[model samples]
Each structure stands twice: as C-alpha cells, then as structure tokens.
Target: MSAGTAAAGPHALEELLGDPFDPTNPAGYRAAVDADDAGSVADTATRALDRWGAGAEFVPASLGGRFTAVDELARRFRPAFRRDAGLGLGYGLTSLMAALPVWAAGTGAQRDRLAALLAAGRPVPVAFHELGHGNDLSANALSARPTADGWMLDGTKQVINNAERADAVLVLARTRADDGPERAHTLLLVEDLDDLPARGFARLPRYRTTGLAGCRLAGLRFTGCPVPRSATVGTVGHGVPTALAAFQVSRCVTAAASTSLLEAALDAVLRFAGGRELYGRTVADLPHAQSLLAGAYADLHLAQATATTAARALHLHPAGGARIAAAAKYLVPLLVEDALNDLAVVLGARGYLREGEYAIVGKHLRDAAGVSIGHAGGTSCALTVLGQLPGLRPAADPPDPDLFSGRPLPELDLSRLRLTGPRADPLLAVLTDPTGTGSAAGGAAPRTRELLGGLAAAARTIGIRAAALPAARRGVEADHRALALADEYARLVAAASCLGRYAAGRVDGSPGGLPPGWLDAVLRRVVRRRGRHGEPGSATSDSALLAHAAARTTAGLSLDLDPDRVVRHRPHPPRRPHPSRVLTPTAGGTP
Candidate 1:
C-alpha cells in the first residue's frame, strides 16, 4: 500500500461520498454545483467529512490524531478536494496550516490544547499575509508590543481564511523593530476571539475572491488587542524561521492534495468524450481528441508524482524539503492548470458549464487557478527556489531509497524542518548521475537510460547557469534571466522525482505498475512543458497511454499512480435536502 492508504485510505472518503457523477447523491458533484451557484458549500458534503473523522487527519498521532505521515494526510484530504475545493480549503486545510507551526514550536500546553481543539472538529484560522504585504512576511505591519501582563497587538491582517468564525487565531506579528529583520517577528496563538473585540480587536469585513468563494476570507484589526505572553507559539523573535518551516510543510501537502483538481477535470473530459460525437465517431474515437485526453492523463500522473514526492521529502529529507516544496509550489499548480486546460480542449462547451454534468470541471478549474496565487504565489516560490539552486550541488550520498518505495516513514518531526536547504540536493544526485548504476535506480531499458542521460546533461547546464549569476542579481528584484534559470531547475527537480518513482517501480516490480510507456509519455510531457528549455529526444507517442486513460475511466479506475477503482456514473441515489451554507465553527470556544 502507498504510505497514505495505510491510514484509512482515500478510498474511504471516496466511498462515503459516493460517485460525484451521480447527479442525485447528496454529497456528490450535483450538490457541489448547487453550492457553488448559491455562493456556498453543501452542508451534506462537509458533514460527510466530519462523519468520516477527517479533522483527525490534521493533528499528529502523538497528539491523538491520525496524521502520522504527510503523504497520507495529503491523500486523506484528496477526496474532499475532489468533491469541492472550497470544502477542502475552508473546512480543513486552513486549520491545518494554522496548527502546523504550533505543533512545530508551541509549548506542551499549547500543543495539547491545539490538538484537543482540532480533535473536537473546531477550525483554527491563521493570520499572516497582509493585503499590502503578500509572501514577504518580513515586511508585515502587524505589531505586538510587550507589556507587563502580556502583549498588545495592533494593525490588521487581511484576506485571512476563517478569520471571523474561528475560535482561535494564529497571528504572525512584528515582535521587535530592529536591524536584524530575520528575528524581528513572532507568532502568537490568540484564543477566545469573542473577547478580543470587547478589548481592542475588530473583525474586518469579508473579501470576495474569484476562487474559493465559499471561504470566510476576512481579517482582524487590533487596536491594542490584549493577548497573554503565554500565547507565544515559539521562541520570541523567531517567527521568520517558524513560519518559513511551516510554509515548507504547507506548500508540500497543499500541492500534493490539490492534484485532485486535475483528476476531477480528467474525469469530466473523459465522460464528455465518451458520450459526445461530432462526425460519425464518438469524441473518444477521434485521434486528435484521444491524443489530448492521453496527454492530459500523463500530465495528471506527472503532477501527482511531483507533488507526492515533495510531500514525502518532508519525512525523508526535512532539511532539504524547503527547496523541493518551493519548487513544487512554483511549478505543480501551473502544470495542473495546464492539464485542466488540455482536458477542457476535449471538453469544449461543457467546460464552461457550472451546473450540469460537467459543472465540476469548470468549478475545479477556477478553484485550481487560486492554488498558484494563494498561500505562496509563484514569484515568492520561484525566488525561494532560485536563491537555493546554486547551492544544490549533488550530495555525496543518495537520498533515502524509501523516499520512492512507498513505505511507511517515521512521524514527521516538525523540529527537523529547516528554514534553508542543505549544502547539496540529494534527490538531484539521481537525475544528474547519468549512469544508471550510480543512482538509486534498478536496471532499466537502454532507451530509458538514454533519456536519463539527456536529462542529466541538461540539469548540469541549469546548475552551472544558476551558479554563474551574481549575488546582486539574485534577490527579490532578480532579473528575468535568473528567474528563468530557476524555473528550469524546478522542472528538472520534477523530472528527477518522476525518474525516482519509476526506479522504485522497477525494484518493487509490483502488481500496480502503471501503463506501458507511461514513463516515456510523462517525460516527454515534461520536456514539452519546458519547451525550448527541455532535453531533446524524450518525446514519444502517447497513444497507448490515452487508450489506458479511456479504459480506466470507463472501468471506474483512477488515472493516478495507485490503481484504485472509482465510482463512475451510476443511477443517482435518492436525494435529500442539501442546504448550502458557509462553514460555521464554534466560536469563543477553548481548546
């Protein structure tokens, strides 16, 4: 089993929610459509997640929760995202993002209290990004002044998810105004929001977003809001490192779980392609349509592979996880967005629908567009990666083989996460080692080795180019050429991850191996994705993969790494009232 399937399995969520294509299932796509139309999410679906005890997936097993592995946590959250991106983000992900830092550095009392709150299914929101300052958390204007009793907070944090309804809030504030910007901020976990307004806090108005519209995207204004000194989540003047580590973890899992959007889009396109006909043949039979569908499937696989590997790196290589997660957050969403658009090519008019059989496709597309810009925008992620690329010389040792073996890993130790990457990138060693014998890879066909040879050569060039750039040209005001090099480096990391997964399959020789030529097809897609910057001679026919996609879709099997049966079209189950409403967490509550 994949590490995640060991814990409750994504199939559990899939089964409980039933077939999304089944128009009448209360917790299915039809309900999702209605909710989106009404500017909210379906209570039935959110409640189904609650019934499944998904909240436990957010807290760690040490803290009496089910989230032992980051990979499993991502998978466990997949079904919710596949059902409704808003449901996944608003109901659970925000809370998890809010709690990770606390788990990483909070005192024993803080950890225990936060765990109890999450266990009881309450949402805990975070405030970090201000409207004026995006990912540059260092420039944040929120200030928490020290006083005898505790600290008094001022300024407003805008565009925060669940800001109004959450019982507690985690705020990243400027704790010290000093020359050392890195140590100027601190994280404060403020609880009991109900009393904050009575003191000096004001809940700000909601901000409407194009995507994730259902989220209560509001803010908090503190005109001397009083929070005890004990509210400090970690050491004083260490918010930068703490938030940086949390960002790595958050970027990894969010990118992994969000790949579900690609899957849902593929499902919609396949459904439309199978039933709709233009000339004399079904759209699925047309060569052009088949090619697009197959390419989209390969992209889906590629996106999932890259995302899952990055998440897995958290356990296997937390010290280097920052760079990989940064790369993923920078590239994977665009890949998914590209794949969605490719499927939309096959989907045509139905891709525009928001309330029909193919409504989920359009909705997922809009929601996915937010993934690239939300939390960490593309520029921030790319810069994070670019700054580290030059230092990514291949490590002397190979990364842990279990990184790709799908084996269970030790519980993710948040303390192990680093604000900076390692002296060398271990995962790159596999891709840069042209000789198959030198890598963690098992024996492969001569042709596969040739492809690796090309990739390795290109990767060396990227590294050299990145290393050549002057330090003056590598900051936030970095030139376009430097950033482009970073983009190329990120793609190579993704391509290397694919090779790692392929190598594991060879050693594993498992029953659930992917379709033949799946590796070649996906590699070429990456090359194609890279355009003029990619390695040569990797492109190959994707016909067989397309046939596999069609067969899998018709058979109700997922077009991902794992070959699990999915709920395809079925007679709609009996319908029940699905009231559309925003998420309502218990406020003014204690953990």
Candidate 2:
C-alpha cells in the first residue's frame, strides 16, 4: 500500500496554480484578494480548478473520480484550501457535501447522475438547513409533499451555495409532516431547474457575509415545484439517518481540510514576523512575539493530528467513530481560530491590511473564524458527542496501530457508517488504559507519563458524569454544563492522539522516534487548554517549539505531523534539511 496523503507526491494543483506569492500571477493571492474585494470568487481560480478537474475530488474513484477515503480527500483539497477558503468551499466542499449522501444512500442512477454533473464541472449544493432553523435541521420548514407522480417541493432553503447557477440542487424537505422529527424528512436531488417556471421555483438574491465574501451563499425557493419519484435520495423518511451517515465523512474531511485556512494565516504571520523590523530588530527577535508565534504553531500541529486521527477513525472503525469525528470537528476549528488571533497579534497592523502581501492574514482570520461554526458548528458537534457519551464502550481495544501509520487507508465504505453505532472509542483507551503501550506504560518520559495520568483521570471523571446524565439531558436538550463535558472530552481525545502518536513513534527511542521534547510541549498545551485556571507551560519549552516552527518555515515545509509533506501553493525548493531532524509521521503525515 502507498504511504499517506503525500504519497500522491506534490499535488498537481500546487504546481499548475503557480506561486501564490507571485504578484503578477492571475491566479495568485493578489487575484484572490482582489476578487474578495469585489465580493465574488476569482474567476481565474474557478476556471483553473475546473480545467484541472478539481470536481473529481468529490467523485468516488469507482465512478471515475479521485475520492477514496476521507483523509486522502482532505489532503488533496488542502492545496486549494490553503489558497482561498472561499474557493475551497464554493468549488470543492459544497459539492462534496451534496454528493456524499447520494454516495451513502442513493439509487445507482442517482450516483451516476451526480458523477456526470460533477464531471461536467458543475457544483451541486446541498440544502439541508433553512435560515430559520440554522443548525437545527430537524425544524426545517421546506416541504416536499408527495404527489401522484412524485413529490412537490415548497418553501425556501436559504443560505445554500451555488443555488443561483446550478442546473441541479440536492434538497432536504419534509415529506411526512405528521411523523416524528427523524422520520419526517427526505433527501431529493432536484434537477431540471429549467423545467419549472418563475412561480414554481426562484433563486433568491445572494446573501452578504462578513467572511468568505467571494462565496455565493444564495438560496432556492420552491413554490409547488414538481419532481419525479426518482428524485428521492435513499428512502422516504430515512433522510435524517442518511444525512447523518454522510455527515461522518463531511465532518471529518471538511474539518481536517479547514486547518489549511489557519496554515495560510500562520504562513503569512511567520513571513511577516521574521522580516518586519521593530525596535531595531526584526519582530522574530522579540521573545514575547516568539512565544505567540510558536504557541500558534504548536496549536496547528495538535489540530492537524487531532482532526487527522479522527479521519483515520472514520476508516478504521466507522461503527463507533462518529464521536471522534464530532470531537475533531468541534476542537480543530476553535484551535485554528485562537491560533489565528495570536498570529494577527504578531503581525500587528499589517495583518489587517487588505491590499498587500499580508492580506491573507486578515482574510484568512475571518474565513477561519467562519470555519468554527460551519457544518452544523462546534456546539452542534459537541452535542453529537454528548449524546454518545453514555454509550461509550470502555473495553474496546485501543485504536489500531495503523491509525497512525502513514500507509494508505481503506476506501471509505459508506455502508458501514451509521447515524449511531457501538460507541467503542479506542482513542479514549490511549488515555485510560494505563497498561496499554499508548499511555503511562508506553515508555513515556516521567513528565509525559504524569500528564497522561492527569488526563486519564479526567477522562474517567467524564465517563462517570456521562453515565449519570438523564437520557433527555444527553442529546440536543443538553444544558451548557453538559456541553462543557463534551468539550472537555474532546480535549482529552486530542491529548490521547498526541500521546498515542508519540508512543507509536517508538518505545525504544530509535532512529525514527519523534523529536525528543515534542510530546512534552504538546501535552503541556493540552493540559493548559483544559478547565479554568489551567496549567501553564514553561517559557523555555515554548521557545524551543517556536524554534521548530522557524526551522520548518526556513526550509519551506509544513509544521504539522507531516513536516516533509509540503503542499503550499508556493513551490519553494528544498533549502536545506530541517535542523530538528523530525521524521514525518512514521505513522502520520506522509509523502
């Protein structure tokens, strides 16, 4: 089997798109910024991606497209997300979201039609929520009443993407209003927009946004619009469950790729901090600035590892992996937003500029902030975990070692993914299982072991509280306090992933071991991010972590688990070997 994402080698988009830094390149950062100013996506980027068949990323490999697994899909799209978050969402993610449910539970003809539309370079937007319901999709007001021939759709699905121009739209509508919340809805791939007259269906005006200005966030209104019975996706009344299964993939893939938004922001700050002078020295010379930059860098790595491990879980254990997917989606975006805030500080006023080289820092800051709430948001995702907590199977074996391995993952089998399954979370075992090689007995150093023990204790405490929660309190009805438990549980999941990755590097500390002190710094970060009055990391260690950040940038590489795997639009040739001697994820980051 091939090694991880990088096994694809330098992505074609990275090479074909040209250096984003080149001021003259029409598809470069300047173009993206300029397009954002005009409140429209850069047409140059749209056409380039279409010409490159970027839509293929959404199609399944079996159907003549590149999609195979969630992680691989994330890695492929990183090159795009790192460029313009709007482009990534408008041209990439939205289509993937609309297509996934079809892949998971559509008639063979529906899947084939989706494959063809995407191949023709058209984005099919999924309309799951209305403006009134927001993340509470269960309350969606759109109605798809059953007709003699098929169904008649009515009401507005606001806040949808590409609604104004797409030839087709995938909509979720109430087919049985009298049924329970989960059974009232159905998914329909509505096509033949031209078949309906103005009164039957209309495209609403584009909604303005504070971030992702260039994205076309529009709406579709259907007033007694008719669609044949073939429009039904999956089974009638099973729409909610079908959507849930597909969400496991979208949550993992989109959450993982969204980190590149912060990567773009951090890249801008590092570039500015190392060069811009302040008080007779470059900003990089300031200790305080170094700490902020380094801490942000460390946060990025943890976010990457956590989201990625969740992606791996989708493949290795889809039955009980929804919690991990939810956890990663909840935490990574928050981590990226906080990191962007720190980076904006280091960049100072220049970070706010909209017309210069550092424009991306300001732009990405806004885009990354939007990421925190996208795809039903961190709060909704946390609820997803809270509902599953009481069912967590503690005796489940630790995550398969292959979860960390850089090798190729199995193809995504939507058939195995469900709305709810055995909540056997192996990542939890990494913290609670003291005898397992992933934790205290995994040859971890004294400080590392101590941190693991504390987190393990916290994990146990949450398990107890979860068991005590009334069934009513475990779901969407959960209060703020119960939601906080989900947040804490997610933090512990991230911690376990870090420790698991470090231990998997090697118990004997051989040639392929992770850098000597990396685990200490990250675990301390995890601990510090916990409950109020959190633990503080040492200044010296934070400085060392900053040095790693600096070294990687100096060599034009990523700062995450996969240090050697460079996917930036700027094709900076190797300057020199990294000074830290960090091996790419022997079981993580690849190429």
Candidate 3:
C-alpha cells in the first residue's frame, strides 16, 4: 500500500479517524463503513471508541479533553473518517457539535460539568435544527416556559445525530415568544434519556441518508420536557450568538473532516490509476489521469491548509472567528466533491460498481454531500457573513464587474514599516532624501531598506505565481481551478504577512508616497484579471480569496504598515446562468 493509504499506521489515518482514537485499527473502522449490515456499523463504531480515545477532541485539556489544538485533531481525524464516513461523522463530527454548546456559551461551571460528563463517556448530542425552520436558531419553534421550580421544553428537533444514544442533549428552546432578539432563547442540558417526559421526546427511525449512515440522525420531539433553571447553558435570550459561536468551531471541524474525505478520494484515485489498464497501458500513464491526480492532490493540500488556518484562528479569536471558519466550511466540501468525481472518472467502470472496496467511494460521496448542507447552514449563509466584511458589496447589474471589483488593493507605507520595534524606522530612512533628510542624509542605516527590499521581492514572487496561468486550456478543470484559487489566496495571505512584518518594525518603512490612484489601478487590474474565463466556480470562490487577503492585510496593518491601497467591494449574490437565458436554442431543441 502507498504511504498515504488509509491502512497506514494510526497517526497516518488520524486525520481521517480523529481522537487519536486508534493507531492500528483503522481498517476495522473501514469495515464499518463498508458493512451491508447497519447494526454492525453502529456496533463497530461503539467499539471503535476504545481505540479513538475519550473526551471531546476540541475541548481544552483543563476541561479533561485530549485535543490541545483544532489542527492536530483535524489531521488525525481526516484519514480515518475518509475510510469510514459513517463512523467518523457519527463519533467524530457529532461529538464536536455536541460539545460546542458548553464550550462556546456555557458558564464556567457548566463547562466543567459538561466536560466531566463527556470524559465519563456520556455522549452529549446537540438538538438545534428542526423541520421547516432551516438552521436559524432565532426561527426555532421549540418553546421553553418557566415554571415556579424550573422550565418545560416543548418542541422537536429533526436530524439529530446520536439522539437515540445520547446521555444528555444541549437543547435550544425559545424562552420568549416575541420575534425580537432578547433573552428569548436558551440552551438546556437535558439528562436522563429514559425519564424524558412521557411522549415529550420520540426518536424517529433513522432516515435513509446517502452518507454518514452510522449516525442515528433521528427526529426528536419534546413535549413539555422539563428542564431545571440551572440547566440553562448561558444567559437566557442569548442562544443565537451562543449557537453561532458554537458553529464557528463546528465549521472548522467539519472543514477538517471534508479535507480528510478529499485526501481519501485522492489516494484511491492514485492507486486505481496505477493498477487499472486501458488502451494497452496503465491508466496512470494516461495524461488525463495524471492531471486529475495532480489536481486532486493540490486541492487536498489547499483544503488541509485552509482548515488548519481557520482552526488556529478559532483558538486565537473565538468571538469573530466565523468568517474564517465559514471560508473553509464553504470551500472544502466542494473540493472533496470535485476530487471524488474526478476519481470516479479515473476509475472508469470499476468506479461505478458497488461490489468492491470502491463502494466506499459512493458512500463517502453521499456523506460529503451533507457537509455543505448540514447544521451550520449552506454556502449562501456563509456568503451572507462574508458580505458583512468591510468592502464586499453585492453585484448590482448583469455582467457585474462590481461583483469582482470595488475593493482597493492593499497598500503598505514602507516608511512606516518596522523591522523589530513597534515604530517605523527603516521605511522612514529609505523615504528620507539622502541629500536633504535627517536620517537618510546622515547615513544612519541601510540594513532596513535591504531587508524590506528582499521581503518585497519575495512577496512579488508569490504575486507572480498568483497571476500566472498555464497556456494549455485542457489542464484547467474544476479541481485545478479550485487549486489555483486557493494558491492565489495563499499569495494574498503571504503579501499580508509581509505587510504585517513591516508594520511590526521587522523592517523599517517610512517610504515616500506613490502616485495618486496607483493602488486603485493595481486593484482594478487584479480583479479584472482574476478568473476572466467565467468558469463555474466553487461557492466560496470570491469570498474565500478576499477573506484570506483581508485577514493578512489586517494583520500587517496592525504592525503600523499600510498597503499602497485597500479596495473595498460590495457583496454580490452568487451568480447562476441558465442556458435559455444565455443563448437561443436550435429548432431541434438542442442547445
């Protein structure tokens, strides 16, 4: 088997399996995903826990959790989950979501209590989504009323994973009837699964889902389910923000899981290409197969990197981490989808069969389908959040350039750039006229300029890569396009990093001013040049690149540096074009 194969050592599959759950038993988990028997899959997952380890993966060590960083957990879980989608989704993702209510909004006491409960092997399921309500917590029809002693929860939550097996459920309920935002909603920790009020909670039969079938995502109904006043996770009426904060973590984890699936798909395609012969040669020798494999690998890397960055951001800035998390959430699932489809093409007829190991591919494809549509809401929701960022405006007209333009290119004041201290020194020296200025004329120092120049040159190299495209049109498939977009995003982030270095006084910058509108000119050029072909793009195409760039620039600006210019664009709704709308059809009815 290849080194990247799912059966590799425990750590190799950790990214797919998550939880350091096990190092040697991944194949067993793989069996769970492949088993024709549903009960067997659930049984396998329940027993697999011994190897996966205990406690919520994202919870802090102080809270009796094993995971210290979200990235570490992501890497470990990616492989295992890829091998067995159902096991991963059921135990890995559902656990992450179940733990979020307490981590994001629970009181200190609540956090300790919930953490302990999880450590003791009691799975906590989150019941937030309901039928017909979409994923909006504010639109929740579930009601919680206060009694003399406590509160009674009356409502139903649909598509709850592990609901039938949960020891406790972090239930979201509307505490107030009004539509206005207030202390109207609350999250209650409901324990005692058996004692759940008579007919208050019912577990509907598992829906025949396309993927992640091991999870018992049954509909749950709560009719006058009593909850204690102390059972509230956070303040009453703050469930919306609390739930959203929890979603940030969920988005990050889900992105990681999707990345795992992509990696698995890529690995499968690589092996299949090598062994499967066609036209008197192995498929691996074919140019198309090679290109597909390469493109898929690149996308896998992009997904992993993006998820890692978002996970780190979650640790640093929990409050405003939504946009970054959403970027990964929106991007990774699409990447996995493209990767799987490409793999199917490479596998040809064998890919279509469900008789062998390849059956997992279809299972994974189904499981991944839900990643974009699950609890955190769809890509549309993610775009709405991106629209709120500074300089993103919706498109106003047909063939709208405003969808891609309006944001100024980031500018940095070289003179204000700092090499080490918080103040600008090297930049000031360079900008100062050597013949007539204070520092420059005095020949105070030249090292800062040299360093700044070197860094700028490196940044330009990245920018060049971002701007370049292969001349061969055949190579630019959907996966390739996705990879290229991610690459550009990385370059933008690198530029932001360079800017931040200068701002931090890592390099001196008090550089002279540029010609008026120079920054605007550059921005316009970049936006116009980006994806000029109008190829169908991922849901996060524009926003992901912009968000990454914005983040880098924001960090750089913190160092007191300035970009030549900053372009802010209005947010535009995602574009969709139909055939009839674009061109006339032939009389034969063929377009």
Estimate TM-scores for all models.
0.91, 0.90, 0.64
Q: Report residue 338 deviation for candidate 2 (angstroms).
A: 0.3
Question: Candidate 3: RMSD over Cα atoms?
Answer: 16.7
Better of 1 and 3 by TM-score: 1
lDDT of 3 by residue, 1-591 (tens): 111233333343333333211223434423554452363254544454434553445456556565555655665564446556666666656767767667656678778777766665566778888878776567788899999888887777888888777877888888888758545788887777777666676777766666566666787787876777878877788777667666766777777777666655554555455555444555665666665554454345445545655565455433334555665676556656766787677776666665564556666666788766767644443443323232221112111111112222222111221111211112122212232122221332343334334433433343234235342321223245434444333333222222222222322222211122122222222222333211122223222322333343343211001222211121232233343444343575312
Residue 501 error, candidate 2, Å: 1.6
Candidate with the larger lDDT of 1 and 3: 1
Q: Which 10-residue window of candidate 1 scores lowest in summed lDDT?
A: 531-540
Per-candidate alpha-carbon RMSD to the true structure? 8.8, 7.1, 16.7
TM-score of 2: 0.90
> What residue pairs are clashing in model 2?
404-587
Instruction: Show where candidate 3 strays beyond 4 Å.
Output: 1-30, 36-42, 56-58, 317-320, 392-591
Please, what are the lDDT tens digits per residue for candidate 1 over residues 485-587? Answer: 7787777777878888776754231324576566666677786555422222222355566656666655667766665667766333223323443222346
- Order the candidates by lDDT, highest first: 1, 2, 3
lDDT of 3 at 358: 54
Top candidate when judged by lDDT against the true structure = 1
What is the Å distance of residue 415 in model 1 from its true position? Answer: 1.2
Per-residue lDDT of candidate 2, residues 127-189 (tens digit): 998877878777888999888999988899888878878888889999888999999999999
> Candidate 1 local accuracy as lDDT?
0.78
Worst 10 residues of 3 by lDDT: 558-567
